[model samples]
Target: MTVTTDTARLPLLLTTLLLPTVARLWPAIGATADAEGWPAAKTLATLLEHEVAERASRRIQRHLIEARLPSGKTLDTFDFAAVPMVSRARIAALAEGDSWLAKGTNILCFGPPGVGKTHLSSALGHALIDAGYRVLFTRTTDLVQHLQTARQELKLASAIEKLDKYHLLVLDDLSYVQKSQAETSVLFELISARYERRSLFITANQPFGAWDSVFPDPAMTVAAIDRLVHHAIILEMNTDSYRRKSAQARAVTSDPGTTAHPN
Candidate 1:
């Protein structure tokens, strides 16, 4: 069955196979590419542009959805009206590119749990990612544990280097547990190495005064906080727990078909 010399349709066949690669942007320039006959150079250029746009869109979605905020709320969805009136200058300062955000300035977010601390930091992280900055989100406990494990494997410096690649790093739940002596020392090293190289966003339930209890060593704790707070915008979230309202809303609207647990 070695039939047919339809060289006329060879280019059209190629375009059909490549159209699916730009499926998201179909019917615009993609549809033009799929039409019969050898495609003009402009059509190929359009396909390339479509592919680039699709890739960027996918990356943006990954950055937004993979953002690890357990509260299931986002900055846009949160009630900023309840947000405290801080200095307008501080808010504006975040928009600027300084050695801190560029070189990775350490940012410390401290307040009680459920006061939108994580939300704000995560939002800032999201914005940074959108602005073409590499960002990573992790819980402080998990980060410290990873560092400990890396030390056991004698790869701590390499692990820290991996983390340092991100332009912005967000660590949530800083008050969950106090760092061990070794963990604290490793954390100090991370703070020093990234002192002005990369920016860090940390959400903590404890205030700066009680931070010594977490680090335990007065001098190192002060140094860590000092590096973190330099040129940082401290947003003290003093609002009541929005989680309570969300929980109450869920309780009132719970499924009628579900039975309550019996004692």
Candidate 2:
């Protein structure tokens, strides 16, 4: 097929205007427009729709990369059957993030180790990111250490403020943070800063009553708990450890001499 003069110039004109998608797809779009006898407005609308979709796709990809969530931890992969107490419908609704995140509502997950708190939190982070909300996932101790370093350099406030861009911050293993004034002070400041402003999704092995070990100071512990629980959704997962159960199942499966009896 011979290229028309106007068609040959269209790609250059579109590229000059910084519309890369339109420039790239103009040939196919032109072919479709001619075959379908589309009006000028329809052809232009088709080009714009593709451009908008391409930009949205690129933005989502960038947000996912910055989120830093763990791999293979999505809502589909989570075993809701194992954790009967947590409602699958509730989780799916929360993942949409329209009601809670917009109101700066926090999510607190309390449980013993290996009960899938980390898994659930990371899964939510992944979902929230896919839903077009910016998210950040970090271990409590690691983030505290970074904040401590920032404080030492007199940049703590700036560092904390930088995190405001994230709609949801996922802090995994809050109990692992050391109980020291330096560590706890910075952690408290972070919680205080984000209180009623941005959302936090936290997974902690310790309950509120035992948080003195985390904050060291009684007043700070109470204050932190007050802010977190004020407008929060609390999920208590007190079941047996998933890892322990998996280990036991593997052991039983490996023992060939074990026989199955009729019920």
lDDT of each: 0.69, 0.90
Residues 1-263 of candidate 2: C-alpha lDDT, one tens digit per residue: 98656666876888889899998887899899999999999999999999999998998889989989888988898888778899999999999999799889999999999889989998998888878899999999889989999999999999999999999999999887768636668889999999999999999998888778888589999999999999999998899998899998998989968987999
Candidate 1 segments exceeding 4 Å error: 1-41, 61-72, 86-100, 180-182, 245-263
Measured against the true structure, the TM-scores of the candidates, in listed sequence, are 0.72, 0.92
Tell me the deviation in Å of residue 48 in model 1: 2.2
Clash count, one per candidate: 8, 0
Best by TM-score, which number? 2
lDDT of 1 at 166: 76
Encode model 1's per-residue lDDT on 1-263: one tens digit a residue.
Answer: 89986756645664687644445444456455666543677776776676777767777777665655444434455456556644435644564445557756567776667767776776666656666566778888888888888888999999999876677778888777585535556777777778777777888888888788667489988998888887575667766776776776687689656666889
In angstroms, give how far residue 24 of model 1 lies from its true place. Answer: 9.5
> Candidate 1, clashing residue pairs?
100-105, 103-197, 103-198, 104-197, 104-198, 104-199, 105-198, 105-199
